[model samples]
Target: MQTVVTAERLWDGTSLHQHPLILIEDGKIDSIATHDSAPIPARAQVHDFPGATLGPAFFDVHIHGAAGHDFMEATPQALDTIGTFLASHGTSAYLATTVTASLDATLRALDGLANEMAKLPQPGRARPLGIHLEGPFLSHEKRGVQPAEHLLAPSIATFDRLLEAAHGHVRLMTLAPELPGAVELAAHATSRGVRVSVGHSNATAAETRAAIAAGAVSATHTFNAMRPLDHREPGILGTVLTTDTLFSELICDGIHTEPEIVRLWWRAKGSERAILVTDAMAAAGMPDGEYQLGGFPVQVKDGRATARGVLAGSVLTLDRALANFVRFTGATIDQGLRLLSTNPAAMTGLAHRAGTLAPGKSANLVAIDAAGNLVGSIVGGIQAS
Candidate 1:
């Protein structure tokens, strides 16, 4: 069946087109016709958003949990619940991210996620593209919510074990590149098709450069769990901010990174290299209360999530992140969409089918009101609101 969705404005990942008519067929976009170019077919279904902006649906490559569900639970119910909640907020897909934990526990989580990812995504739910292993190989001094006892030193054998347990579903891994054997581990992970991101480390600038030389392409949640920048030595944070090729992930919830720092980082990385992520825990989309993140107790009060008096994760959604980013950076909606949609799609290796609202791409899109608020979403050509 063919369907036509029309909106007052359309952001095709580059610029906004006025009064665009998008044609979707068989879960992929067939074509895009402007108001002056063609007429809508009388027989086909038409969805008209009179005063809304339509664009590519958001993709979060680094999110943990939402709606009273944590991915570390490793259950189908948790996966489905989170996915459903994400779709309602205009998220088309996300990575099921993991945290630092015992080797056995982490393996169990990976096995469960691998099985879940193999199945088809239910209607009205976000697609779980892959897994992001955020810890177990990290700096002990910088471990935020990760238990110190479970932190492991960088080793090829352990990484191989994790790769096997995930059934090759691990798309990204975050490690402290300053640790022993980290450069070699980065090379090995890259050789096996896994992207290495530098984070949760106290690595020096020179050490960070060496990791980048070994195929580290991104920085995880910049400045939160890593070494601070210094003009004299310019630690990991300095290297990440200065490097042109390395992508930086920012948690724009206004709690993780300050609004001013967010603006600075945005200026540094721009739309092409900066990515937005919700390092959210189970408290996201739920009322403020107690929650669990990676088997540790956390307190959520007034939208802030913390553990042992330390900022643990977050309670942010990508839609809110987009709004905050626009407010902070004073960027156009078209440029902001690149951070949430284009960069993440490329980072996750889904650029062929996802990201842009173009012919032959998957019909995944989000609808925002004229005031820049999310109103609805379409996932895999199905309305999800």
Candidate 2:
């Protein structure tokens, strides 16, 4: 079946390319046409958004939980609940990120997620791109919400086991490059098609560069946890800025990184390289109070969440992150849209089908009102929850 969706404007993420209608066929873009030039064909449905702009469905590289559901729980039903909630907000896909916890709990969660990923059907709300392992190997001093006791150096055997158990569903791993065997572990993970991101570390500039040279392509939540950028010897941040290919993640929730710094990173890295991620937790779509991240107790207050008084995760939604980027950076909607959508997909190697609205690309798109509210979301040519 063919469908035509028309909007007041269109943003492919890379740029704002407004046309009268977008033609979707067989769950992929068939053509982008001007409504005035082409007559609507029979047997085709037309969806019109008179005053809204159509944009690529957002792709969140990092997110833990939302809407009274969390990924760390690792239940199929729980993930589906989260997926339904995310789709309503224009998220088409995301990595179910895990925080540091007991080895047993981590393993159980990983094992469960591996199974759930395999059982999921094709049609749904936002889908899981893969599992993102954010802990078990980190710097205790900067563990954030990760349990200190669970923080340890990488063990190839254990890491390999977990990855194998996931059966290639684990897409990214976060680690501190200064730890023993960290560089080697990152290299191996990258070799297996999983990206390595530097984070939760106090690694020096040299150490960070070494990790990047070893295939670490990103910094987890740039300007947080990891060493701050210094003038003489820029630390992890310096390494991110210096390496042209280095893509860094950002939490645009105003609290995590100030709007000014967010704008700076956007300017430096360009929208294509700075991926907007919701370092979100269970409290994201819930009210302020106690929640859980990877089985650890978390408390949210004043829109921020913490574990044991340390900044734990976040209570932010991806749509809100996009608004923050616009409000803080004063960037046009086009740039912010790319940072939250196409760019993140590119980093994860899923841009081929999921990112922009182009001929032959999967029809993952969202409609936004002038006020930045999410009006509607679509995934694979279907209306998402």
TM-scores for all candidates: the values are 0.97, 0.94
Q: lDDT per residue, candidate 2, 1-385, as tens digits?
A: 8888888889876567665588888887888877787778788988888888889999898999888777878897888888888887889888889888777777888888888888744544788888889987788767776778888788777788778767778888998988999998988888889888999988889998889888888889988887778898787778887677889899888888887788788878886688889888888788888988877788888998987888887888888887778778777766777887888777888777567888787788888776676777778887774
Q: By summed lDDT, which 10 consecutive residues of candidate 1 come out lowest? A: 367-376
Give residue 298's error in model 1 in angstroms.
Answer: 1.1
Flag regions of model 1 displaced more than 4 Å: none
lDDT of 1 by residue, 278-376 (tens): 988899999988988988889999989999999988999999998888888888777888899989878767776568888888788988775557887
In model 2, how large is the Cα lDDT of residue 333?
69
Q: What's the CA RMSD for each of the models?
A: 1.4, 2.0
**Candidate 2 global lDDT:** 0.82
Q: Candidate 2 at 15: error in angstroms?
A: 4.5
Best by lDDT: 1
